[model samples]
Target: MRSVFHGWWVVAAAFAVTFVGFGAAYTFSALFAPLQLEFAASRASVSAVFSIAGFLYFALGVVSGPLSDRWGARRLIVGGMIVLAAGLALAAAARSLTQVYVAYGLGVGLGVGLAYAPALGAVQRWFVARRGLASGLAVSGIGVGTLVLPPLAAALAQSVGWRGAYLVLAVLALVVGGGMALLVESDPARRGLTPDGAPPPASAPPPRGVALGEAVRTRRFAGLYAGCLVCGFGVFTPFAHLVPYALDHGIAPTRAALLLALIGAGSTAGRFLLGGLADRLGRLPALLSMFVGMAAAMGLWAAASDFAALAAFALAYGVFYGGWVALLPAVVADYFGGRAVSSIIGVLYTSVAFGTLVGPIAAGRAYDAAGSYLVPIVLAALANLAAAAIVAVTARAPTSSR
Candidate 1:
């Protein structure tokens, strides 16, 4: 069997499953209203579920990365699919708010933690030269999921009840995600090719491994970690709140849903387009540009009152956000080398998990206290500005050569 051919196919397949799984998670903003109405829950409380899930996913990144290094990405991802399906099924049957929290927040979160970051690490192992684009393409699954799933869930919730809708999603995730996980192999070297698709040097020995603790102590690892933290704080707030805020502004619910989808659609375009660019422009420049675009998008979102403006913001933001997702990990690999990319990237993602955990709660509280979404929007815009600065400072790191 040709490992390289099968290897790329596995990477692409993993990307597709992850895109849907993460996208379903991103679509929570669209579900926020219905959930609130159904449970009569406060936005703060409901938003906490996402935070909890994100925290688990990120915190576990610390462990999952090391574990994948010891075990493999295939087991983690497959186990995650099973757990994810089970979590959703349990969530669909949840009667109280606490049950939802346990099922979706903790249970589904466990599945997410297992699957998402490991896939990135796995893809990194397969391609060295194209790692940035490969990672982006893999992560961009969230964008594709965001674009498709939320509306489908929303429409399903409208007719079938939110519980039933969740049940459907649970089944869909299980079959597709499980099948893909079964197909995923951990590395190309297992089949005898070197990283970047070139033939291995005749003298090269088999790949050596790095310890997780050693990986984090390095300066490059610390810089990437900080940059991802700032990026998470800014990136999640918009996706989490945009739909509710749009409805508050008197936009029809369906249209607001469409706007959210547009953001995902924009993200999809950005990932594919920018993945290639990161292959050429260097990861730092590509990432810095994405943060700048995110800052601008937040500013535009702050001022937006109509569909046209929101649409423009989504398209523009999606492109850069998509690009950033694609390139940042590859940048780290360039500095640290791919030998322990997953563990290194996993430590960096701990910061990202922190940002995602905090972003929505802070934004939700800001809206509740201020009685408008403006404060949160402005704050998010400023957060993006800060992210840009972090990326700028860190851009001093090596772009391609390790």
Candidate 2:
């Protein structure tokens, strides 16, 4: 009897890793109001907590990517989970917003930063033909986490208080994320198999492609970097602000929080359905559609007011957002090959880091000043359209060397 391929196990582990890490990180939506009330802070200030954490998690990918290449992904993933758990635990004890920033922002940011890229990159090394499917399945954890965790955290906060909720999440991060991290192996070669479980040829060369330096020098990388950076400005706006936006419209808190779950639901569908579809449709084209789709979704958000309309916007936005997350790494692998893929992916994500750092806080400040999310929502929509233009231009350019 044939044993199941080990790559699938790696994918499962990556899924769990992302689920725990991102679930915990994204639970900030549930914590946002509580923290704001507790700290007596302004909207932008509270939003900065998430922005800071988001920035670290994405930006740290540059360091974590290279480290994963040199030291293997498993250790970094395990260590990151531990750090994340500690950060959450410390956040539970915070007496001030600054402490919360130091505890949650630095902790969750660093933890996800350590684990996310390495885990995502490890999956890339294990499949070629089904890379899109596997990558989608692995990252669908984020969508799923986004669906499940925020509501759970909101419930926990109701029962146990927000600080206690943080503590509970910390334990979950340590146990679930850390245990799964153990299963993450860096490459298929270690298991005496090849990508997609093909029978190994007698003399397969090591994974070959351009080095990170050369890859970064290419026009393709520049286009991807620029597009992602621009897209980043709008990509995370909804995650941090959607609940508040819903609340301002007189939605009940519980139902408002569930709107994020709607996003998670849409995101999950997109990753699973669109991911497989991209393999058939051409990933680059599918990717361009995602940007366009998101642009339209943001436009819907700008016009939405009632629960039904907002829910529609959430689902649409999430679908495209999920596809964008699922496709970027796969697209990077497609163009650049496996060599230095993790490192290249890490550097590319810095564009997202800068955007994440600014986008949400800017939205919050816009809302505070204008007493409406209109300007930011409209801007976010335009940003996605700009990203679509950049990606379309990239599609016309020649492919980079492997």
Q: Model 2 over residues 80-147: C-alpha lDDT tens digits?
A: 99999999999999999999999999999999999999998999999888999999999999999899
CA lDDT of every candidate:
0.77, 0.90
Score every model by TM-score.
0.94, 0.98
Model 1: per-residue Cα lDDT over 185-237, one tens digit each: 67776766666678767777656544456656655556677767877875777
User: How high a TM-score does candidate 1 get?
Assistant: 0.94
Error of 2 at 168 (Å): 1.1
* Cα lDDT, model 2, residue 291: 93
Off by over 4 Å in 1: 1-4, 206-211, 397-402
